[model samples]
Target: MSAWRWLVTITRDSRSFFFTFATLCGVVPGVIGYGVMQVTNSTNPELEARLRKSARPETVMMGKVNQERLAEYLGELKQKQDTNDRYVAALRGETLTRKPYQRIQPVPKPSDTVTTKAQ
Candidate 1:
C-alpha cells in the first residue's frame, strides 16, 4: 500500500539478499565519507597518551558509587530488621523449647572477713 510497506514486504520475503544489498549500499557511503575526512585529519600521540593516563576521574566516580552502595546496604539492614521483628511478632503466641538448667548455690556461711595483708 505504501512505499515503506512494499520495502518491508520485499525485505521479509528475501531477508538475506536484501540485507546484504542494504549493507553494501551503506558501506559505500561510509567509505566515501571516511575518504573525504581522511584529507583533513591530524593525530597527536602525546595527547592520546595523556588522555589514557587520566584515570583519576574513573576512581572518583567509583568512590561516589561506593557511597550509593553503602546507602543501599543500610536500606537492606532496615528491611532485615523489619523481617526479624515480624518473625518475633508471629512467634509471640508460640511456646519455645527452653533448655532445663539451674544454678547451684550453697547455704551462706556465718559472716567472715579475711585480711589481704599481714596485720
Candidate 2:
C-alpha cells in the first residue's frame, strides 16, 4: 500500500485512541479553563465591577412581531430559498430556468479637491 493510504488506514484503525487522546488533551484543558474563568468571575469583585461599568446598557425591547410583517418576511425567505435551489441545481450540471442576472452599475467615487498649487 502507498504511504498516504497506509497512514489513513492507521489513523482509521486507531480512531478510539485518537478520541481518548483528544478528550484528554483538548476537552479536559478547555473544561478546566472554563472552570477557572467561572471561579474568577465569582471570586473577584473588582473584575466584576469593572466588567459591569464598561458593559453597554441593556435595552428593554420585547420580541413581539406583527402577523402581516412576519408573513412578509417568510415570503421573502421562501423566494431566497427558491433562488438558492436553482443555483444548486445549476452547480450539479442541471439547466438554469431563472432569468439572466442584471448588470450592476459602477459606483461613483468622491473627487477630493485641494487649494495647494505646484510651482
Best-matching candidate per lDDT: 1
Cα lDDT, all candidates: 0.64, 0.59
Runs in model 2 with CA error above 4 Å? 1-12, 43-119
Model 1, C-alpha of 87: deviation from truth (Å): 41
- For model 2, how does the per-residue alpha-carbon lDDT over 1-119 read when each residue is reduced to its tens digit? 69868756776789986677667889889999999988866657898778766765542122133454466447758777444654455576554322347322233444544333321
Worst ten in a row by lDDT for model 1: 95-104
Error of model 2, residue 86, in angstroms: 26
> What is the number of residue pairs that collide in model 2?
0
How well does candidate 1 score on lDDT at residue 115? 43
Show how many residue pairs clash in every candidate, following the order shown: 0, 0
Per-prediction TM-score, please? 0.28, 0.28
Query: For candidate 1, lDDT tens digit of each residue in 10-62?
Result: 88899796988699889999999999899766587887677657859887689
Runs with alpha carbons beyond 4 Å of true place in candidate 1: 42-119
